[model samples]
Target: MKLWKRAAAAIKDQKSLLAVGFSRRASYRNTDLEAAIIKATSHDDSSVDYSNAQRVYKWIKASPLNLKTLVHALSSRVNHTRSWIVALKSLMLLHGVISCKVPSVVGEIRRLPFDLSDFSDGHSSLSRTWGFNIFVRAYFAFLNSYSSFTADQISRTRANLRSDKVDSVKQQLDRIQKLQSLLDLILQIRPIADNMKRALILEAMDCIVLESINIYGRICSGIIKILPAAGKTDAARSLKIVNKATSQGEDLAMYFEFCKGFGVSNARDTPQFVTIPMAEVEAMEKMVKSVEKDEQKQEEEVVEKAIVLLEKPRLQTIITDKWQTFEDDEYCFSEKAIQEYHQDPLPLVVSNQPVCYTMPDLITF
Candidate 1:
């Protein structure tokens, strides 16, 4: 038979049987016809049946498959009954069918019993589904482990500091250091995965850093307040060591840089630097003052030299005056007065004839 003829006949048969509400007579006849088709198709031993089975599996996997459609397909041998459909059903059950706790048509399917051996074949779609599910489970398990470890560390630190006897500065510093180390460990793991899980791990690490910084700041403040009054040099030294160690840690260094860049300096009454016992601060101030004095002296010397230079005499150019004689027919002043005039108020009138001069020749020429 032609392929379209077979498909048309199958559709017609299915429609007629479905119209009858799958009555006992029609169901038995359809089941026998389905069995005959299965036997005949199997004789050829082609992969068409397997491919059809995969198509049915994909459809069922993509959405909630109804029992009626599954039963119809299984009875018609359009898809497999024992291998494909039954195995897919079992895999769905293993994926937490019940606690998915869906309260709808899907809930009925979840309530069905499933056998493990139905999907025992490794090549089955059932096994592939289960493998993906297992991966998800393992990923979550790792997340839980990281979260629990961080929470436990925080709880222990809180417990340690709760007792008055245990509030020693050394112990507090140790706790902060351990917390910093744990944060580093978390950050190291963030780059290992490429998915939502990695994103979640990074987010968790950020929270840990924030929480740890808050705790460390509080402890350091407490230590600072008590250490100065206790007058214990060893306690102060330990605090310094803690500060240095924290600065060396990568995350702590980043935090410090961030705070230094953006945090405002609070106005506290400047604590007496005298009590700090390190003379470096005082020496630095003294050195700055000395440098200022030297600079002022140099400026004063420059000004004094500039003033002396300003007081010195500046040279002036002198020009000798020459007298010229003119016979003034129309005269306003006497010739004696004109000759005795050391400076001329105006030029004397001279003859109007033009005069020219030529260069002198050399004696050899």
Candidate 2:
């Protein structure tokens, strides 16, 4: 009664005192507010009087303690807690200017569900986003928790994001962009001892098999045939990249002539090429034989299917046996066969270059 009387009197007579009280005790821990809240709400709106209860609630909300206290008091006293939370939520819905402590603000945002697509403002600016402040907090929360912003750099960026209320929606978006860029940079900096075997294998294939001297490698059928270039080696480097390796080359000098193009390797999505054993290619040939003729013809068809699936070398040397090497155009498909294979009638270029695979449509039958 005394607190209520004091509040009622303060609202009616001393508005400045109530405002000062709210200003000091809203965010800080305070002793007077709990007793005031209890006193202010103990009676019906008319009984304790509207002015007092209204003033007290306003003070509490202005203190920004309403949400913080509502969250802290949500426990076994479910009904009372629910009323407080419901009232706080109503206040949140009513006001956008109000701000609370970061942890409490984070907890409040955690209670709701949001779709990422809902926040696209479609404004031309890079910094603009819809659902501005709430999404900023939520996206930061989402990335840190799900994306595991666990790296030192990411953790630090997240800390910075939480510590400040970015001035505008655009600023919030920029902060997120900054954080992601930092995260990407961190990912690219591999520790000195850590090994990335996939990348290393791709580098090898890019260097050895795909660009290997006097050889053309295809992974689908897993063939690496050694071509006879003047500088081509009979003794190859690592053959771990292919299933079958044959010292065979198609002399395109008779079919076409040498030419040059861009020397840079800009190809993407290079699958891991490793040296598979001859046993695998043998097993493949045997598997072809194992398939009945009704299903697919013999080993030659199997090799052909492999070449087809591999989708390389418009002309490939189809060796029936391991000893059948390319002596001349007898084992090779004619230019007519090569020309008919391509649906697009673009004239093909045959080059006597060091690495023959660069000729996009070179084939051997």
Best by lDDT, which number?
A: 1
User: How far is 341's C-alpha from truth in model 2 (Å)?
Assistant: 58
lDDT tens digits by residue: candidate 2, 51-118 = 43454455555645564543332211122321222222222221221122233233343332222322
In Å, residue 272's CA in model 1 sits off its true spot by 25
- Every candidate's lDDT: 0.39, 0.33
The root-mean-square deviation over C-alpha atoms between each candidate and the true structure, in angstroms, is 26.6, 31.0
Q: What TM-score against the true fold does each predicted structure earn?
A: 0.24, 0.18
- Candidate 2 scores a C-alpha RMSD against the true structure in Å of 31.0
* C-alpha lDDT of candidate 1 relative to the true structure: 0.39
What is residue 194's positional error in candidate 1, in angstroms? 5.2
lDDT of 1 by residue, 1-365 (tens): 44664465456445544644554554223433333223222312112244433444443444454333444433343223323223332222222222232333233342223222222323235533454233333323333333344444445655767863455555555544554444444333222222223222232334334533544454345444444433233343444544543453445545444433332121111121112223433343455566668779999999999999889687999776965656673253777667767566677768788766876887756
Task: Report RMSD for candidate 1.
Answer: 26.6
